[model samples]
Target chain A: MSHIIKPILYSYWRSSCSWRVRIALNLKEIPYDIKPVSLIKSGGEQHSNEFRDINPMEQVPAMHIDGVTLVESLSIMYYLEETRPQRPLLPPDFIKRAKVREICEVIASGIQPLQNLTVLIHVGEEKKNEWAKHWINRGFRAVEKLLSSSAGKYCVGDEITLADCCLIPQVFNARRFHVDLRPFPIILRIDRELENHPCFRSAHPSNQPDCPPEAIK
Target chain B: MSHIIKPILYSYWRSSCSWRVRIALNLKEIPYDIKPVSLIKSGGEQHSNEFRDINPMEQVPAMHIDGVTLVESLSIMYYLEETRPQRPLLPPDFIKRAKVREICEVIASGIQPLQNLTVLIHVGEEKKNEWAKHWINRGFRAVEKLLSSSAGKYCVGDEITLADCCLIPQVFNARRFHVDLRPFPIILRIDRELENHPCFRSAHPSNQPDCPPEAIK
Candidate 1:
C-alpha cells in the first residue's frame, strides 16, 4: 500500500465533475484539502500551463492522492473507491455494481461532457445553452427511466453509491441551466430527499469555499 | 457466485462504445452471443419500447450476463472484470489503474459522446463533419499527450488495458470523420500495432455479424 498521504483536490465550485469528486470524498469521510481552479477567471485558469502540467486535459477536479496525480472526475471517484474500499461507495453485488456504474456513465459520458466548457466554446454563443439543454434533456430522459427500476432513497436502492455522487451534481447542473426538472418526478424526488444527506450536502457547489458570491445568492 | 450464465451482448457493428465492450469480452476470452441492435436501419431498433425494456438509454452495448441486464459499455466491462478476473483489463497498481480509467473517460465521455449519433442529428448538415473533426481532433490532442508518459506497446504499458479498449474505437471513428492523424503519432502507432491483435481484430466492426456490406469493403 502507498503511504498514508494527504489528498489534494484541484477543483472549481461549479464544475459538475468537480462536485462528483467532492461527494465521493465526503462519502468516504477522507480528510482532504481543496485548491480552487477558477474555470472562468482570467480566461480560465485551467488553461494555464501550470495547471496543464497537473492534468494535460486541463480540467478541474484533478487530484493528488496515494502517491499519484489523477485526472478525470469519474476515474478519480473509481480510484478512491478501489483503494479506500470502506464506507463503500459501490455495491458489492456485481449486478447492482454494474447498474451503479451505468448511471455514472449516463451522466459522466452521456450528459456532462456534451455540455463541457470546451465543446460549448466551439458550439459558439448561438447554440451553447441549446446544446447543453439538448444533451442534458436527452440523457435525463433515459436516466429517468433507468432510475425508475434501480432508484430507492438514492440512485441505487437506498445506498449512497457512486451513482448518487454522479446524480446530485448533474441535477444541480440541470437546475442551473433551467432544464426543467418537472418531467422527471423520480429524479426530482431523489434529489429532494438528498437535499441535506450530509455526504452530498457538503459537496454541493453552493457550500464550497470557492463558490462565487453571486452563486451563493 | 452467480450461476454460470451465457452472456448476451446487445451491440451494433459500428458503434465505438459497443466495440469497447466487444474488445473486452474477446480479451477475456468470454464466449458471448451478440444481439444486433441496428442503430441505422429503420430508424434505430434501439429506440423500440421492447429494446427500451432492455436498456432505458436506447443505446447499444448493453449486456445480459450472470442473470442480469447491464447497460453502458464501461460498466459492462468493469462488471466482467469484477466477476471474471482472469485476464484483468486494469493494472494492479492504483496509479496505473487511474491512468487507464482516465484514458477511457477521455474517449468515452470526452470524445465519444460529443460525436454520438443523437448529438450529430442536432449538429445538423452544415457543421456535421466540422463538429466531428473538431471534437475528435481536440480530444486526440489531449490523449496523445496523456499517452506520452504512460504508453508502451499498449495504452498504459505493454499490457492491454481498458484504455486500449477505448483508444482503438475512438481512433477508428476519427478516421471515419477524416480527423487528421498526422499529429498523434503515439495513437497511430498504438492503433497500427493493434491492427492484427486477436482481441481487437475479432471485435472490429468489419468482423461483426451485422457489419454493413459497404462497410465490409
Candidate 2:
C-alpha cells in the first residue's frame, strides 16, 4: 500500500460544491487542510492561471491527495470512497449505489450548474435571483418525488450516503435563493436532519475559516 | 448467476446526455432497446405523469437493467461499469479513473446543463445561441487544457473511457450551437477520430430511430 498523506482541499466558504466535499471528508474522519479561493475577490480567484492549472475547469472543490490532484466535486467524493473505503459512503448493492448517484447527479448536474457563479453572472443582476429560484425549484420538485420512494430518514436510506452530502449543500443553496421549502418537505426534512449531524455541522459554510462574520448563521 | 436482461434505454436522439449513455452501451457491446422520449414535442413528454414516475427529474437516458430502473446518464454508466465490467469504460488505475470522471463532470455539469433544452427555453430565442456559445466555449477551454496532459487516442488514453462518451456528444452540441472549433484542436482531433469509430458511429444521433430526417448530418 502507498503511504497516505493528508489531503488539501482548495475551497471557498460559500460554494455549495465545496461544502459537499467538506462533508464527505468529515464523514470519513479524514483530516485535511483548506486553501480558500475567494470566488468574488477582485473577480473570481478561481480564474487565476495558477488555480486554473490545479483545475482547468476553474472550479472547486479540488483536492490534492495520494500523490495526485483531483477536481470536480463528485469525482473527488468517488475517489475518496474508493481509496478510503472504511466509512463507506456508497451502498454495496449495485442498484442502490446507482440510485445514490442518481440523486447526486440531479443536484450536481441538473440543478446546481444552472445557478452556479458563472451562469448567474451571465444571467446578470436583474434576473439572477429569479433564474436561480426557477432552476432550484424545478430540481427540488424532482428530488422530492424521488425521495418519496427512496428516502429512509435520509436521502437514499437511513444511513448517510454520498447523496446526503450532495443534498445538504444543495438545500443550503436553495435557501440562499430563498426558494419555498414547503414544497419540498422531504428535502427540507432531510436537510434539517443532516444540518445537526456532526459531520455536516463541522463542514457547514458558517463554520468554514473563510466565512465572513456577517454571513455566518 | 442471474440471467441478465437486455437493457432498455429511454433516450432522445439529440440529447447529449442520452447520447453519452448510448455510447457507453454500444462500447460495452450491450444490446439494448431504445424508448424515445421527445423533448420538444408539444412541451416535453418528459413532463407527463407516467414519464415523471419513471424519472421524477423527467430526464432522458433512464435505463431499465438488472430488474431495476436507473436514471441519470453518469449513474447508469457507473452501474454498467460495476455490473458489466467487460469492455470497461473506466481505467484500472484509481487516479486515472478519477481524471476520466473529472472530464465527464466538467462537460456533464459545467457545460451541458447550462445549455440544455429546458435552460435554453428560459434563455429565450433572442439570446439562446449566444448563451449556449458562451458556456460551451468556457467549458471547452477547460476540457482542451485538461486534454493537453491526458490525451492519447482518446480523452483519457488510447482506449476509450467514459470521458470520450461525454466529449463527443458535447462536441456535437457545440457544433449545433455553431461554436467555432478551431481553438480546441485536441478536442477536434479526438472527436474527428471517435466519430469514425464503430461504437460512436452506431450511437450517433443521426442513426437513431427518432432522429428527425432534417436533423441527420
DockQ values of all predictions: 0.81, 0.90
Give the per-residue lDDT digits (tens) of candidate 1, residues A76-171.
998998888879999888789888999999999889988878788878999798778988898899899999889988889988899988988898
Docking class of 2: high
Please give the range of 10 consecutive residues that has the lowest summed lDDT in model 1 chain A: A1-10
Model 2 quality (TM-score): 0.98
> In candidate 1, what are the lDDT values of residues B90-118, reduced to their tens digit?
99988899999999998998889888887
* Residue pairs with backbone overlap in model 2: none
**Chain B TM, per prediction:** 0.97, 0.97
Model 1 regions more than 4 Å off? A1-4, B1-4
